[model samples]
Target chain A: MSYCVNCGVELEQSLGQCPLCNTPVINPREAVCNKSPFPEEKGQVEVVKRKDMSILLTTVMVSTSIVCGLLNVLVYSSRPWSLAVIGACILLWVILIPIAIYTRLSVYTSVLLDGLGTVIYLYMLTFLSESSQWFWGIGMPIAVLVTLVTEFLVVCFQMLPRSFLTNTLYSFTSLAALNIGMEILIDRYLQGTVQLGWSTIVLTVCIIVNITIITLLSRKRLRNAVRKRLHF
Target chain B: MAKREKPIPRKDWYQLDLSAIVYPTLHRHDFAPVYRQSVLLTEVVDPELLQRAVDLTMPRFPTYKVAMRKGLFWRYLEPNDRPGPFVQPDIKNPCQPMYFKGNNRYLIRFYYYRNRISLEAHHSLGDGTGCMCVLQTVTAVYLRLKGYPVETAFSKEQGYFVMNIDKQPDPEELEDAYMKYANAKFCPPRPGEKTYRIRGTKESFYTLNIIDGIMSTSAVLAVAKGYHATITEYLNAVLLYALLKKQESDRRLRLKPVKVAMPVNLRRFFPSKTLRNFITMIYPGVDPRLGEYTFEEIVTQVHNDMRYHINEKFLRGDITTNAATKRHPLIRIVTLFIKDFVIKLFYTRVQDHNSSAGLTNMGALKVPESMKPYIVRFDIYMGQPFSSRTNCAIISYEDTLTINFASSIIEADVERYFFRKLVQDGIHVKIESNREMTLEV
Candidate 1:
């Protein structure tokens, strides 16, 4: 006989609270007594375990790296050519292990680990040849810059309220910065003088796109029109 | 020596009806086209008696006692050689995704929670009317097992809904009536626009929140009679209004069409007796962008819309198009791989794009008079829509018309507005839910 005071709809005697508004149902004349509509036991779909996939991946990568290392030492004793294959296996393992094994691994940690793995692989490649200067000057700086820019973009996407315009603005701005940073590092390594040629064109186009996006963000009607047209 | 019993003759396999061809192709791990129909009894259900009832009723439904198998050209239903699915304790989550490979290949699952006996069947098996037959029979058998003098017969004069378990399976019951009644000469094109969708925070994939608003059928029917509309039309108007109000609360212009898909039972219009998904959806909607409408105006629009679309000629044209497409040389010659890809693409992109929400009124269920004294009420609950946030189903037994809302989101605004609107219309509603809400002092 109890009714929700807020919704004004009578509730089942079995219900202690109103389902619509979550209001307490208390009738001083009647004691609340009846079984619920559903049972106490709840069932849920079983999530497929990723641990088996992680074990399989580890076995494959480890065996491939071992086979390549043994071939370089025993069969092809002339040079250590297997370093490249082993480095590739190591890089892939580092990137996929986090995704397959852990659910709570943050995007920031994954991107940083990928950067470190790439740097190590490049360093390993330098061992096959006598040119360590290219790896230090070009490979190290570019990989680190790409990873840092990606991490910054991920942070921006997470921290800010996301819409089509906001996400595009973040992307174009980061693209320009990454392009400029890469050119500077490449210029320093190749010619020892800072000269911007192709990056300026990219920077100009990015600036124009970013300005257009900013304009669209500021005007609701225009943003809605573009959304309707683009069907995003 | 023990006396030997006579073996019942049945078909080993059945073809997927015209309407059923798309459901299996559109099935996903997160989505399955499943709906539930349950009966509430006066006493707590005994699991042993319920299991015996299920075991007795499973063999009577030839079209339902089968499992899905992939054929070279199409997927077909073959009789499951294993035993019937065992009855299980009902869970808070009623209709989860169903897979055919497991659980003895049973397409239908039975659950008992206290006085409620629920039957969750895949849409591919049959429509609500078809499954209702199985549910009513199971309930009647359970009552008989519990020492009630419940009589069962499948006389067409009385009605085709009630089943006789001892009789042999009929070939006409297993026939695909869609192919039988499809007239290719009257094929009509059904073009649709992308309709507005209710946006909300997504809950976990496994969670389905069910809220039931139990009300008196006479009270609601009297109100509908006042409006010069049928119960389905009146309820649809109320649902659309509730959705419109929810959309307007966002303080945005209500430009998108607020439409609810109403599933019409083909048996009412045609003479077909088979129960293999003979239903079509009619979208009765209001174009809020056109202008503001009063509640009376919306009712008139929905009433006229439903009256205009629900006819034998129009529905025949619609089913004709589907049947023609299925029988086309290009469609039939292709292997199932290509057919499945096309069907999946069409279903995901175009099928549910025309409706804001869905409302299915199974219309007052008629229980046999002998078993009426022991039954409390009947309920029909639709599973979550693939695109819409919530969908509703209605069924009534005796004087109680239970409106069940199945939602995938965490919000209760839609259900609140809907019931409050009914209460405002002078209909008394009693609310209950599978979810237990907290009470603040």
Candidate 2:
């Protein structure tokens, strides 16, 4: 940190002139050597880092499906279940993978992908098994709910405030609202064992308690600590 | 010499256009037109005393008051509504506001009712000092009629400010305003004693919402005196301090000097009172940027600084542009075009934040206690301050003063703030809103 020659104000960025005093910055060679050897990097401009995660996306899904298919073949040798499972995996990849990875993609794309996956999985189950009562009555709703819940939680977590407490409160509040609405929709729109079970009750209880604690913590005076970002 | 089809010469168009560019609520508030808020010494005006004053004044003036009815030679200010290209269809009519293109072609208005009187004049003709003289003369005459012994001791103070000039008043503008039954057309008659001109009331722009809590001029003076400051200095210093509390900048704030336009009566300067428009203006600006000084220190500066300028700096002949030497035909043509747009624009912006609002001391009004008890109350008329937009006018009638601020879209807080600050400074104030408007003057 160099001080301005004219006004003695601190200089932030090293491109030379100070913002407050408009004084040029100079790196005196001897002064630089006298400073600490390692310090937190200062005056760095932020840039977005693009992760090369796409190339590995399809490969991982295909390999996971193949392993499950091979396992199915070994478990049931005389049945066509193994072939069916493999077909299901290939269809899921074809329909869902692209939807999952659309960069600069919006929330609607994510929801659409979850919808497609639910339809395909449920269709396969219905066609493949006639006597499986659990899959027909309870299993289909659970599958769709799980997929939607996971996607929504992911989206909420990403969009929440950077502070830990605010983020937690936001996630809980959003999830609670989403779940209650979804429960109403499920009961009215779907039939048979439509009521929410014990797991749903447990999740709701946890969210409510956590949200209360967060709300209490978010009082006025304490919020001052969260205002450091507004200087600009 | 029965000529027809005369051209109405285009002139001073810019200064005239200033009213158009800056609306009354916004721009008019910036500059303080010279205000000498005085009281009519109405109780005692002995004729012998006034006659003595007139005798002394006449040798210098030659033609004291011009007659319109008494002389039947000059009469246009009563009302004019001809559709000239520049003359606006005089809105807020009966055109009580003086209308003057230059010398001779102008109006002098005096509004009166019972014992109260107000004098409003157009600037192109003369300055405030001249108007004040006219007001003083009118007051003296009224007191005599009401039966009072006002000694006519001739003091230079009374006639010390009138202006002397040799140029004749301009010829009548239109053949239609007055049909020349064969006189070529008389010069607009100068105000002589026989034919006195009159106008309606000059109302205070806005009704000041004064919360009168029993503070007086003496109370404020005492507080300021405690700080080794006079009334104005103490008020100005305290005002500056309050302004400092609202902002975050550590750097000292510097407001452009608050400018008050002082109209110098030219009668004393040259030695003539022909009543043919001879007045000039002076802009007195007070600097408020002394940066974190103690209240006492700031007050001392304001007191000493203002007292000095009130005499020497005022009427130094540099305030208003001198139209004498530059009254060439070519210059008038250029000025006519330029001033048509420029002067009005200049008044609009300059009058606001640069000068802010005005504080005019019309001085103590004198009257005998027996006949009329005492001078009851008086209000000084000026442009009002605009909120978030314009300026205000402050006129002091001795112990009481009116703060008039205006807004196109009025808000309650701005007025509240003005009074709040005044009360905080230990000033006794009262407010009168649109309840009592001045008729016209």
lDDT of 2 at A124: 60
What is the CAPRI rating of model 1's predicted complex? acceptable
Candidate 2's C-alpha runs over 4 A off are A1-232, B1-108, B112-115, B148-215, B238-301, B304-317, B320-335, B349-353, B365-374, B384-409, B412-415, B435-441
Error of 1 at B273 (Å): 6.6
- Every candidate's DockQ is 0.41, 0.01
Query: Per-residue lDDT for B1-441 in model 2, tens only?
Result: 123334334221212111111221122322222122223333433444444433333222211222111112111222222221111111111112221332233233433333345444443223334445445554544444455543323343343222211112223211111111112222222111111001112233322221111135566677777778655556555434333332213233333333333333343444443243443333333344434455455566656755654452343333222332233365445533354355455444443334333333333333223323434454444333232322233334456544443322222333344345555555554333322122221
What lDDT does candidate 2 reach at residue B255?
35
lDDT of 1 by residue, B1-441 (tens): 123346667677889998788888877788788899989989999999999998988887888889999999999999886876789988888788887765677788999988999999989999999999989999988898899988886486687467888776666778899888888587788858777778876767777888999999999999999999988889999999988888787576546888888898988888877867899888999988888989899999999998889999888888898898888998898999999999888877877778888899999888888998988998888896786478999988789999999988777778888999999999999887877565543
Residue B384 in candidate 1, Cα distance off native in Å? 3.7
lDDT of 1: 0.86
